[model samples]
Target: MRNSMHHQAGFSLIARVLHWLMALMVITMLFVGAGMVATVSERHAWLLQLHKPLGITILLLVIVRIGVRWAHGTPPLPSDLPLWQRLAAKLSHLALYALMLAMPLIGWTMESAGGYPVILFDGVTLPALVEASPGLYSTLRFMHTWLAYTLFLIVQLHLAAALFHVLVRRDSVMPSMSTGPLPGAKRSKG
Candidate 1:
């Protein structure tokens, strides 16, 4: 029982590292994106430069993350968790992965459609995903904006759920990805 519980309560170190790293990057990207859209000054250009490469980086990381997840499955939810909660957890994760993937692709395509080069850095330009079309660019821009809003809301919900598991239910969910043992977790005798 102790061994099984320990296994269930901890994520592999690589998984934890990836989780925290991507979380920080995603949060930073969100703010940078907001700043980019809200300004028309020189800052906007600077932010745009940052946003493009960051988005691509996130896209690449998420692909690697998905591969890791597939190779090493996540810890199971507490067996006693309510069915509704389980369903919600699964659905929310699916949504998160989908959005994480979709947002970058849409942004890349939008830029392509707008006839803008996706320059990662000096002399490094990504090929366009779509041909330039003003109409398509407009449509994709609308999608990218609404999807960003949706992603923000979902991220909030994910955070709330993690807190609920830690504070309200006093469960192992958060500790699975936590570097340190969560309060109330059992420690084996040496």
Candidate 2:
């Protein structure tokens, strides 16, 4: 039989690890992106170098994460949760997934339109998604910046909802993604 802690925690070990890993990577990428845009110093170049590969890594991980979620469905919400809250949860998750996929693609396309290379590492570069065009680059740059702002807002809301589950609701929602045993879960006295 599978271990009780794993069962009680709701999410598989791989899922929980991926969740936390991607969360950290995404948050770091957001900060790096903000820094990259906010300066013209030498540090801007360094941050840009960091940003490209990180965004691509996030794009790849989110794809894998979606596959895992599809294979091993997410745990159910609290049974007593209201209908509106459930709907909000579903919509927010969908938005998150959409942003995860869109942000990297748009960024790559923007770079392509600007005639810039997306170098992942030593001598590794991604192919251009679109032909070079200043007009298209300008449009994509605007969209990328605005979409980044939207992503930041959605991320904040997601954090607030997670905190609500942990602090206010004191529910299994938080435990579902945790590696530890679920709070208040029954233990066998073997």
Candidate 3:
């Protein structure tokens, strides 16, 4: 028999790993992005190089994450949730997934418009997608900034909800994502 006591219907091991890993990367990217916005010195040049590749990596990870989530459904919300609350949860998650995928593409397009090389770590580089156009760069940069701000707000909401589930509601939702499945989540037989 499967260890029903141990696993929650939260996420697969691969999914969980990628989820948290991407979370860490996103947070780091946010900090680096803030630094890039403020600093204009040789010291910050390395961050500029790191930013593009890091974003591209996050984009790839999000693609994998979406695939995993599609293959294995997300754990259902707590039964006590109202219909609207549940709907909000679903919408919030969808928004997060969308932004996670979109931000990098916008950043890439912005970089491409600026005629910058999409250099990865260890000297690998991607081809430029477009000639430098100050107009397109400005527009894309604005979109990327706004989208990131929206992502930041949504993430704050997501984190607050997670904390509420763990601390106030004392529900399994937190544990499902934090560790594994809840105590009573059923395992799907493939």
Badly placed stretches (over 4 Å) of model 2 are: 1-9, 180-190
What's each prediction's TM-score? 0.89, 0.89, 0.88
lDDT of each: 0.84, 0.84, 0.81
- Residue 188 Cα positional deviation in candidate 2, in Å, after optimal superposition: 17
lDDT of 1 by residue, 1-190 (tens): 2223344446678779888998898888888988898989999999999999999999999999888877666666767789999889988988988988999999999999999988999999999999999999999999999988888888899999999998999877888788644445434221
Residue runs of model 1 more than 4 Å from their true location after superposition:
1-8, 180-190
Candidate ordering by TM-score (highest first): 2, 1, 3
User: Cα lDDT for residue 73, model 3?
Assistant: 64
Q: Model 3 — which ten-residue stretch has the worst lDDT?
A: 1-10
Error of 2 at 20 (Å): 0.7
* Residue 61, candidate 2: alpha-carbon lDDT: 91
Which digits, one per residue and each the tens of the lDDT, describe model 2 over residues 1-190?
Answer: 1222223337777889988998898888888998988999998999999999999989999999889877776666666889999989989988999999999999999999999987888899999999999999999999998988898888999999999999999988888788544756423211
